[model samples]
Target: MSETLTLPSHLRAVRAAIADALGIDETEAVPEATLLGDLGAESIDLLDILFRIERATQVKITVADMADLLQGGIPDEEFGDENEVVNDTGLTHLEKVLPQFDRSQLTEPLTADGVLGLFTVRNLTDLLTERAAAAGADAA
Candidate 1:
C-alpha cells in the first residue's frame, strides 16, 4: 500500500535538505525558489540536492530515475531494473547499493516540467516510507 505524506512536514524537510545541500539558510528556500537563481545552485549543486533528498527520504533514485522524473513520475515497471544494487555507503553489515547512474550529473537544474515531470515529491517520499516499512516487516 502507498503511504501519504504530511505536506507541511515533508515540505519543511525537503526545503531543509535542499538548503543544507546548498549551504544556505532554509528561509531562503521555497517551493517556487529556483535552485539556480534563488539558491545559487549550479548543475553540480543540483546533483547534490538529489543526493541530499535521497539521504533525507531514503528513496534510492538513479540519474535515469531523475531523468524520468524530469519527464514525469516513473511507473513501477520503468523504475529501472529492480535487480540493480543501491549503494549503501557507511553501512555496517548490509552491503551498500550504489546508484545506477553517474552521480556527477545529478545537480543539473530541472525545468518546471523537469521537476514536476518527475514523480511528485510526495510520491517519492511515500516510496521511501513504504520501503522502510517493508524492511521493518521483514525484520519482524
Candidate 2:
C-alpha cells in the first residue's frame, strides 16, 4: 500500500518552489526530506530555490538565515582541525539546527561536509513558515 504524505500548505508551497527552481517534478522533491542528496540539488540550485521561494511565498530569505538555522550560531572554536571536524560541542550546537534527525546516526568524525548534507526540504519549509508568521504578526 502506498501512503500519501500530506504536508502543510506552507510546506507544499515551499516544495513546489524548490521543484520549480530545480526544474523537476514536485513529487521528486519529497517533503520533510533532505534537498541535496534526496532531490539532487547542487550548490548552484540553492540560490535559485531561495529566489523562487521568496517570489512564491513573499517571504525574504537570506543566506545568513540558512546558516544560522543549520549551524545554530555555533562559533568556529568548536571545529577541531583543518578539515573542520565537528567536535562534541559543535555536534551539540548542530543538533539544535537539525532537530529532525538523530545526531547518533551521524557518521563518525562528522565534518562540515556532513553538516551541509543535513539541509532538508523541511528546513526550507520551516524558514518560510517562520518568516510568514513573523510578517503576519508585524502587520497585525
Number of the top candidate by lDDT? 2
- What TM-score, to 2 decimals, does candidate 1 have? 0.44
lDDT of 1 at 69: 35
Query: Where in model 2 is the C-alpha error above 4 Å?
Result: 1-6, 79-82
Residue range 1-140, candidate 1, lDDT tens digits: 32224346546556666678888876677555555555677667657766776777665555465444333343433432344221222111111122222334546532233332233334444434555577568879
lDDT at position 53, candidate 1 = 67
Work out how many backbone clashes candidate 2 has.
0
Query: lDDT, candidate 1, residue 84?
Result: 28
TM agreement with the true structure for every prediction? 0.44, 0.84
Worst 10 residues of 2 by lDDT: 1-10
Q: Mind giving the per-residue lDDT tens digits that candidate 2 earns over 62-122?
A: 7678877767766766544567888877777777767776778865887776676688887
Alpha-carbon shift of residue 27 in model 1 (angstroms): 1.1
